[model samples]
Target: MTWKRLVAIAIVIAVGFVGTILAGGLLPSGLASAQQEHREHGAPSSAPAAGAPTIAAVAVDFKFTPPEIRIKAGQTVNLVLTNRGAILHDLIIPGLKFHAAAEPGKKGTASLTAAKPGTYEFYCSVPGHREAGMKGRLIVTR
Candidate 1:
């Protein structure tokens, strides 16, 4: 594309994005409401599934409190991430496809079933957070 045409396209895209935000169309209605509720009340009050172990985890400004967690293979793990810092934090276990995000002073939850025994790294995907030491290790034991 020509330079001028590219610039015009960029401007149009930016304008559309801004308009969407201003019109409160950034997220769908159900998601927005759920997000609001999550921010206000943390995770749901429902009980954990049978035979699943609930592991409490906390995230701070630059690190996860435990820094590491240990669980068993062939077991389902329920991780609860609580953000006590002044910013958002999230837990992501790559291979497990498990992710839980918590806003400041709020909480989130996710479940992962580790089928093998090994070490898996968990980190916050937030920009610069992992580099700042916001990460931990999940040690799955057989």
Candidate 2:
């Protein structure tokens, strides 16, 4: 094959490899990590409404103490999140715009105003924490 043809084939192969990596998301090209970062830190959206009341939540090693909570509507609530685990964890409820951070063997507390009555999801934003059942629920009532 001519030298020009060989060079063209090499360039095509290089482009194909780059495209494959981009499509497969095997590289951290910033764009590919956008969604992953959001997913990792986007825990609050899983919460219920924001107009309910105050409720307390606690976090522990791979678990959330008082995994279930109940509260009233229109009443300000306080969530006492205490991280008893050996790693960092965060309590996020985007729907309520509530976020709390806890460190290993340390206690953390966060508060949120509940504007509606419903059940909200609570989980640890730490890697693999939620998947390990490090989660709970915020139940609001009127």
Candidate 3:
């Protein structure tokens, strides 16, 4: 390539690298504080205690009471599922590989001991539930 073209390409690559770093550095302090809050709340990005259990929240209808769940490895998961819907519903955590069915005017729960850390998908396995857009993620750290 021509000397000028080569110099321009190099500058572009340099600028891109710097831009990424700057953007990352410029991320809001809220994000950092949020991470700190997680740490303070005992949410580590690694294996959970051997007997410690994770808490998962399930949604009802158009709302996810607590849209996200985070947990350490080797911990038991207590999936607290509430049905805010007027009809029966279900919440399935694919990563933890479990499901809980909820009936109207009642609460439901599914429990599991998570030995591994990874991302999980949750969906209403109840017939036609997922088709109504009842689904979310269950993340396990590591």
Judged by TM-score, which candidate is best?
Answer: 1
Backbone N/Cα/C clashes per model: 0, 15, 3
Model 2, 84: alpha-carbon shift in Å?
Answer: 1.1
Runs with alpha carbons beyond 4 Å of true place in candidate 2:
1-56
Runs off by more than 4 Å, candidate 1: 1-51
In terms of TM-score, how similar is model 3 to the real structure? 0.55
The better candidate by TM-score, 1 or 3, is: 1
TM-score of each: 0.64, 0.61, 0.55
Please list all clashing residue pairs in model 3, or write none if there are none: 48-73, 53-76, 54-76
Looking at candidate 2, the ten consecutive residues that score lowest on lDDT are: 43-52
Give candidate 1's error at residue 95 in angstroms: 1.9
lDDT tens digits by residue: candidate 3, 1-142: 8999999999999999999998888776646764453233221122333554546565577546576677777667666677777876666555554656667767665566567787776666555456566667667776
Tens-digit lDDT track for model 1 on 1-142? 8999999999999999999897776457746665554354333333345767789999987999899999999887677888999988888777666678878999887777789999999887766677788889999998
RMSD of each: 9.2, 8.2, 16.1
Model 2 lDDT per residue over 1-142, tens place: 9999999999999999999987778555554554465366544322334553444556776887788877777766556566676767788765677777767777565556778999999777665667789788878798
- How high is the CA lDDT of each candidate model? 0.79, 0.69, 0.62
Residue 98 alpha-carbon offset, candidate 2, angstroms: 0.8
**Candidate 3 regions off by >4 Å?**
1-58
Q: Indicate the residue-level lDDT of 10 in model 1.
A: 97
Which pairs of residues clash in candidate 1, taking residues 3 or more apart in a chain or in different chains?
none
C-alpha RMSD (angstroms) for model 1: 9.2
